[model samples]
Target chain A: MQFLSIFHEINGDLKVVEKELEKYVLTQEPELTLAAGHLLKAGGKRIRPAFALLAGKFYRYDFEKILPLAVALEIIHMASLVHDDVVDASMTRRGHPTVKAKWGNRVSLHAGDYLSAVALKLISQYQDKRVLKVLSRVTVEMCRGEIQQISASFDAEQNLRDYLYRIKRKTALLISASCELGAVVTEAPEKIVRALTRYGYHVGMAFQITDDILDMISDEKVLGKPIGGDLRQGIITLPVIYALKHSQEKEHLRELVTKQVKSEEEVQEIIRLIKDSGAIKYSFDMANIYLNKAKKELNRLPDVKTKKTFKKLTSFIGERSF
Target chain B: MQFLSIFHEINGDLKVVEKELEKYVLTQEPELTLAAGHLLKAGGKRIRPAFALLAGKFYRYDFEKILPLAVALEIIHMASLVHDDVVDASMTRRGHPTVKAKWGNRVSLHAGDYLSAVALKLISQYQDKRVLKVLSRVTVEMCRGEIQQISASFDAEQNLRDYLYRIKRKTALLISASCELGAVVTEAPEKIVRALTRYGYHVGMAFQITDDILDMISDEKVLGKPIGGDLRQGIITLPVIYALKHSQEKEHLRELVTKQVKSEEEVQEIIRLIKDSGAIKYSFDMANIYLNKAKKELNRLPDVKTKKTFKKLTSFIGERSF
Candidate 1:
């Protein structure tokens, strides 16, 4: 599998990128700085920055330009994660206590606001108005996606199209913007920018779909949280939708999710039922479809070291059990 | 009083501006929309928009250009208020339940994000790069201000200079930007823009200092919140700082504040001590210094209708108690 192969190369860039992220996400307040460091130390896939750097390689391959954008994307991602932890009331992230859990919700929220402002300020140094414009708009879209999710939780009437749109905003826009913005700031041609954008969009879609599948089927050690947490929160992912279509137990599961559970056993039963219904496999198959499409989009770009890594990412998403 | 004389004109503009705020702030989510409506309906002086409009009148008084900038300023103000409420864990604002109080912290935080995004998007439509740059920087500065306040809270050793810097960010940047941006978009003369910016800066400093005094001395009916709320939260305002400089009674009050009171009566006693110590008058005197400075800045501009209103605003701050 290209997954391990590509991961090795992506790791080579990690130290350099990680240094830039630490430098930029910092604050003047020592407490906040430490809080931010604690959060950043929590391991992430660094997916946005990887894509940003790969896309930049297609143009001038300048780390000077790419590093800031990379750092900015990661900062933006980190900021959103901070707020998301608050919204979800999540205690542990990546097997460690989340910022909100450790410090408190107020500090977590302020830290997120701090990171976001710092991201905008860092990008403003680019003097590239387009980067600011895109970053600002993507930020707004991500927030709108959160609002949509909050408003539409557990509505069985919600369809796949709505789910797709939500993920597009919540997950894909920043990734796509990262790729496109990387190209734009490097003064890449319009066609190259479009190709990179399409590649990011499909890859982002596949990435999120795999995430949904993992939430349903992966081990807690791998996922770093309880399986079916999304379901417990009344977030109906693709697997649940698929399971509902086939199971005679659908009505009971729906009822459990729609109302607050009185006991842990009830939640366990719902998770067990969803797994037995083959919904996890169905969602994985759907994700594979997007992965194939994402790979196809990458074929239009020239063969390069980064493109090889981008190719490997498609397979990584498809094969990722965690 | 000029406030009485200008009341009708200001009220007319505020009514229109408040309606615009409602149109934008109201998410389709019924609960959130209701909470926003309550905050909007609980009315205050719409100073940001007024400054924008008055500044725009210096060159071209077209509401078409000015109104958007005005609304953008107000949106930024409202967004900051939402975030501020989250930071403070505030339960009441403007004599009503805050968004956080009614809808929870997550909803309020997301609502603030939405409002900020809306403001930036609206400002992007102006097609003036300089205006966009200035507005974006101000938004970042405003965030910096919030970070400063969050850092300063409960830090008994915070200096007056740091406090001044914090308030300039927390409160003054938006008001100053409102005036400067309004002028820039209208293509006003350089001198006019500079005058409006300085005027707005001084006026904003005065406004925040007055707010600090009112938090100690104003009644709940007038303040729209419990008196001594800042003290309860361990925020050392100008009045508290001034009082801390004098009197053994001030030491006792400071001790009470540091001890964390459990009863409203304890809070009341502290408030009485601050009032009896002449701290409120001392803060008012400091505010007058800023007001006089604001008036001096306005003198640089030739006598015009807008400049006259600007002068009136300086006086209005000195006499807002009426």
Candidate 2:
């Protein structure tokens, strides 16, 4: 099935979020407007906002009441990505020039700053301090995750635990907050909110795992950037960590991947070596475990059509190859 | 009277804010805690937080209720300064190595990001949404101000209006919010809130103008950084702008200040030329206008002791040479 199928029911609502996102990012400064709006135009899957919108539907769902939060979740995601690019000194994202690429580091830094403040503005409109609290805590963790990743980069001795902790904060925490805050905004009951939060957390972990795997094997065209990009940058994702610990060519993998600079050929060779090992299967099984845990969380929810959609989303994540 | 006397009444209260600031910055990541706490250890005036605390005293002021906000205000100031150092590539602040200098730009960037999130967390303690709203809006404007300064840097053509707008957002807005949020969190009457906010705004403007003037003539040892640092960076301030337009050697001044780099001799010469041009007096006049306007706003408030402090603050800002 197409990945679009999971969000098909809410595509119209997502479109509203997309439109409002443009307006929310507009500012008095033209250059700022351009830089802050740059990533939104480039576009992502809108998965976090979709997760939020879907989670909000589990209770007294009002689209207008929930729209600001949905938009804010996506903006938070975009804000982090903008700063991430600055940290990485990345020149491109989504096959287009990144904000950091067009503007200098200073503009990109303030653009990210402006976006984060904008997100706060949107979340503040909800009047529930819980939403702001959850986001603030999660955003802090997200920043810590980014700092950890920077510190952990190119370290051959980093363990599986290190990789998990990093990804948990870097990706899973915000995704989990999306679901939790969505339920909170909709006034979902305690049980429902907890279930959805755990579900989102598990799905987020699996999603990031799948992304790590795809970074090795996905067509560069499909991924919209180079394959092994993470490896080239010494991020040492799940598969690489697994290969470093368990693969037949562990020594060579460690030496090559831990190198400060990797040639294109070196990156390709490392990718090939990891693929030939069982790391891909090992990583897939791990992701499936998370998918199963995510499905178990839906079992706690009331038998609504949304639950069925949740099942399909998990299944899609399980079988997703790209 | 000394600058310390302005906050003498709140010395103990400011101490609480200082202690809480240390605890607020602690994270699971020790390096992050260190980087975020570095500036806190290197003391500042605690002026923004003191403004909030003092402003909280006008009506129904509860010390415990406002303490979180006071600490949060200082954290916000530190966060901006940390990010500002990155934007300026400044290696030192407050006569010490900056976060950007001790750690890399990436660490400093994430450190700033983490501090901002912590500020949001602190503000979330209030059930009232207005505090968040005011903060979010002010923070966004602050970012826009920073970006404007970057874009305006080194451009010889910027006018007084450009400098005014930039400083309004860059300095005045947050200081205004500091006083405004204190009034808000204390549930002060709307009339009083408006008075304190305007008071903060005008005082902030004068405060920045005074800093700009001092940047040209203050002792390097007293100012804690090199004199003429702003002029050297191509940031045209009010006094420099005045000199650029009115000095006998306007062309020479412009040529020297606008150069991408300057030797110590050129910096000294540029400072001497601007000081001799009557630009210092012109800039001082602008600052006094703001201070006088700030004092007038206090007349609308109740005859509380805090109002008297506000008056003295304006006076101190007017005449403080250091």
Task: Give the number of the best model, judged by lDDT.
Answer: 2
Task: Residues B1-322, candidate 2: write the lDDT tens digits.
Answer: 3767788888888888888988877666776766666687668788888889888988998889899898888888888987765642221332343334333667778989989988998998998788999999999889888888878887889999999999999899889988998998899999988998999999899989999999998988888878988976678899988999989999998899888777889989999999899999999999999998988999888898888888888888888877
RMSD vs true structure, all candidates: 3.8, 3.2
- Which candidate's DockQ is highest? 2
Error of 1 at A279 (Å): 0.8
lDDT of 2: 0.84
Q: Name every residue pair that clashes in candidate 1.
A: none
Let me know the TM-score candidate 2 reaches against the reference structure.
Answer: 0.94
Cα deviation at A138, candidate 2, in Å, is 0.7
Worst lDDT run of 10 residues, candidate 1 chain A, spans A88-97
Residue B1: error of model 2 in Å? 9.8
Instruction: Identify the leading candidate in terms of TM-score.
Output: 2
Show where candidate 2 strays beyond 4 Å: A26-28, A87-103, B26-28, B87-103
| lDDT of all predictions | 0.74, 0.84
Candidate 2: clashing pairs of residues: none
- DockQ each candidate and list the results: 0.38, 0.55
Cα lDDT, model 2, residue B276: 90
